[model samples]
Target: MPKPNEPILVALVLAAGSSRRFGSDKRLFAYNGTPLLQRSLVIPIQLGLATTVVLKPTDELFLPSLLGCYLHHPLLKVVYADDALLGMGHSLSAGIRSILQSSKSVEGALVFLADMPSLEVKTVRDIIRRFDSNKIVVPTYMATNGSLKAGHPVLFSRPWLKQLQKLSGDNGAKELLKKNPENIINVALDDKGIFLDIDHPAEVPGAKT
Candidate 1:
């Protein structure tokens, strides 16, 4: 729970992409017997953070799966991105707009990818715990190639929303991070789940069940 007088914070899950690279609707793809999008929502729901899910405006086939999560999770808000095909950035901007419009008290938004089901609940919690009004909190780790890499979910302070809402194309928040590298507070973690995302069937890990 947030401290008294603290502005509301939300987790914005970007799930609007058409999954052209995967050759299928990866958001609805089953991973470990659960839809991948739902898996991504697990940590957000468990932490009781207000979450907003962004999807394509024309998308209906995945409503059954999405609705199931929404019905059970009162903190979840669903919004549609009419220009989702424009790219992930547009989807992100749309989700942020919807969040601010609906929740006037929101001061920050933590961006989470819908295809990344391996992210642990603790990772999400720690990120939220470190969020500040002036600095962007990012979770990072070293990839298999030995280079350092930043991973989600990234928390952007309220001050970054104007630029965040102007984002477009597939870059997502990369441009913002690049232009404001000095404002970033990197939180290094031991979990490899931060680096795992399913973009193709071959990349899906074995189901626990």
Candidate 2:
């Protein structure tokens, strides 16, 4: 867990990847009139002052378009990842490093994806409700009768920052998630937003509609 003013928990939105599947700027795609990327950025910023974004080195053209039009918020700040093509692990590492590099005073980082606009701020607020000195919390939603679907807006406590920053390849926090099940406290939820991510152009319409 992190101290409130200590800037312990920062929102790391990985927005550097090219949306090859969508064939368009998935980050800028509008949902209910607001760009999905902008909403992603806003969710964390509105919750904490330490919210930061990770952006891949990209053409000045499209990057600026979204930043100005949608992601432009006073609390939102940008950190650059040099190689966006190295997959999600690189972007995740870059985002955590950016904060660790700028200030060691940070407690932990909370991670979210760019295309998941279905998640609510209350869901995130609930996830952060149990901030502590050394525990990781993850949200699990009820899937069906007695079944649970696991996902994130993951809360990484301070002790795991080193493990998270050392991540590579296509692997995400799953490795850690499996290794430390006891440390994980399930933040129960039932919303589909916990699993909704725009992977294709068709998903965009379904999520928004």
Candidate 3:
């Protein structure tokens, strides 16, 4: 539970991608007996964060079949991004807009990618523990070769929400991060799962046909 005056943080899961690189709807692919997208949602939802999943406008045709089990989840909100094909930026913008429109108390949001199912729960908890309303919290891990690498589910504060809403194209938040380098708070994590995202069937340990 959050403290009386602690900023409210929401989880924005971006699932509106067409998965062109994966050659199909990778979100629905089975991973460890659960849909890949569902796997990605588990940790965030389990942590008790109000999560918003962004989907393509056309997902309505198969929404019932794809996410029926999660439709009634009390903490979940599903929104459609009509211009999802335009890229991840659009989906992210739609999600941030939905959060702001629905609640004024949300002072920050953790941006999650639907294809990243390998992320560890501890890593997420650590990020949440270090949340700051005035700074962006980014997770970083040391590569085997001794290089530092950044990871997913970045926490963006309220001041950056408007910029996120104005985002366009598929680049996502890369440009925003570059522009405000000083505002980022890098959290060094020991978990390598932070950098793992399944973009192909071969990437899964035992992918189904």
Candidate 4:
């Protein structure tokens, strides 16, 4: 629970991608013993965060079957992006718009990618703990080749939500972050899961048949 006057935050799981590169519905792809999206959502649900999952308008036909009890979880809400096929920006904008209209007192939102199930629970918690109402908190990790890489579930403060809502095309929030370099606070994390996202079938190790 937040202290008196502390900013309230929410989580936005972006699962509306068309998965053109994956050649199938990657969200439903079996990872370990669960669907990929379910794996990505476990940490947030476990943390009891008020989360909104953004999906394509067409997902209504099968989401209930894919998500099972997750659809009924108290902390979760689902919103569909009618223009999701337009690109990631449309999905992101729809999710942010839904957050703005919700009754919750949200001062920030952590944007998560549903394909990145490898992200650790501790990494998500650490990012939430480092949140600021005026700056974007992004996790950074060192790669095996000694290069620094920025990873997802990027925290965007309230001040930037409007910008996110106005986004268009497939670029998502890349341009916003690029233009406001000073507003980004990169927290270094030792976990490589931050950089792991299953974009191809070959990436899922120990995947269930």
TM-score on alpha carbons, each prediction: 0.92, 0.88, 0.96, 0.95
- Please write out the lDDT profile of model 4 over residues 5-116, one tens digit for every residue: 7568888999998888999888889888789888877988887778899998789989775677697888999999999999999999999999998855689999999999
Q: Name the candidate, 1 or 4, with the larger lDDT value.
A: 4
Better of 2 and 3 by TM-score: 3
Q: For model 3, how does the per-residue alpha-carbon lDDT over 1-209 read when each residue is reduced to its tens digit?
A: 45687668899999998888899889889987888888878988888889999999888888765675787789999999999999999999999999999989888999999988789999998998888889999999998898889988899999999899999999999999989999999999998788788888899998784
Give candidate 3's TM-score: 0.96
User: Model 1: how far is 36 from its true place, Å?
Assistant: 0.2
Better of 2 and 4 by lDDT: 4
lDDT of 4 at 62: 95
User: For model 2, what is the error of residue 29's alpha carbon versus the real structure, in angstroms, after optimal superposition?
Assistant: 1.0
Which residue ranges in model 2 land beyond 4 Å of their true spot?
1-7, 59-61, 69-72, 206-209
User: Who wins the lDDT comparison?
Assistant: 3
Q: Which ten residues in a row have the lowest lDDT in candidate 4?
A: 1-10
Give per-candidate clash totals. 0, 1, 0, 0
Which structure is stronger by lDDT: 1 or 3? 3
List candidate 4 segments past 4 Å from native.
1-6
Candidate 1 residues lying further than 4 Å off, grouped into runs, are 1-7, 144-146, 207-209
